[model samples]
Target: MTREEREQLLARYTTGELTPLERERLFTEAMNDQELFEHLFEDDALEEALSDPAVRRHIMNTAPAPAPAWPLRWRWPVLAGLAASLVLAVILIQRQLTPSSDRSDEHTSELPSPCLLLSPL
Candidate 1:
């Protein structure tokens, strides 16, 4: 099916407006298109959530407050610092997870005894 036709069918399906044949055709297409199926599943979930008054109330109650405005100079410095820190963290994590011969030996080796060193001395 064409992308436009699939989208129109999906819209109708989401709105509970699809005829049985259209619904069946959409389902058949969904079987072939994983991304489309996931989108339709999310839309169905959203529709169900909106239909429930309790879920709507909870979402509204728990919504985060908007961020306060900051000066451009302050914002740029803070954002740059955060981005640098994030990059550093990712690099460190990657290094730790990737096995290098030297790093693996350091991690696995036990410390030598102080007494053994003193005796040699």
Candidate 2:
């Protein structure tokens, strides 16, 4: 592409006006054409170019939209399952913490210390 063509392409790209095909072609050409690639950065550091919010926004707008993580149909079921598990966990924890009438407090209190069980008598 001529210098004018390159400039025009870059201009469109910066405005987020390039079609997907045009964007792909621009990227492919930039990879293959050294002059076009240098024109992209204009001798500036990659970091410097990205640091400009306008440049970052333009780049983000020009990129392809990402696919959704999963279908919406599955979302509610998964959330409900997680909530059920959480309730079950809380119930189990509460049961463990409650003092049961079946075991006497005296029986629990008179048990040898764990450290004594581990050490020599």
Candidate 3:
């Protein structure tokens, strides 16, 4: 491969996106070419920032301070209450539409259901 092609392949190899055959070619080229090996080494250094906690903390601390833990802890319970309310609403609607005869004391609607309009002749 030409110098530019070798550089592009080396960048892909550093990103771990190169196939095995491409990686082999990159390794072979790096061994024969000192400048390509230096380029790969520099790319490796750039990726080292991810695994370094000090750098990570410095980057994260630049943003606003995070919220307190209490709100985060209550988020699940709030979501569960909303879900339970939805389920209760659905059950109440279903009961109103088709109430059991055992509860005759409750005020029930006397209107003919719109459902009968969809019946086949």
Model 3 per-residue lDDT tens digits across residues 1-121: 7978986897688668999999888888888988888888777886798679998888788988877977888889999999999999999999999967866644345544566455676
Q: TM-scores of the models, in the given order?
A: 0.52, 0.32, 0.41
For model 3, what is the alpha-carbon lDDT of residue 13? 83
CA error at residue 11 for candidate 1, angstroms: 2.2
The candidate maximizing TM-score is 1
Where model 1 places Cα greater than 4 Å from the true spot, the runs are 67-121
| Model 1 Cα lDDT, one tens digit per residue, 28-117 | 999999999999898989989988999999999999987777766798889899999999999999998898999768866876645643
lDDT of each prediction vs. the true structure? Answer: 0.89, 0.82, 0.83
Highest lDDT, which number? 1
Question: Candidate 1 at residue 62, lDDT?
Answer: 97
RMSD of each: 20.7, 15.6, 13.8
Error of 1 at 48 (Å): 0.8
> How does candidate 3 score on lDDT?
0.83
What C-alpha lDDT, on a 0 to 100 scale, does residue 96 get in candidate 3? 91
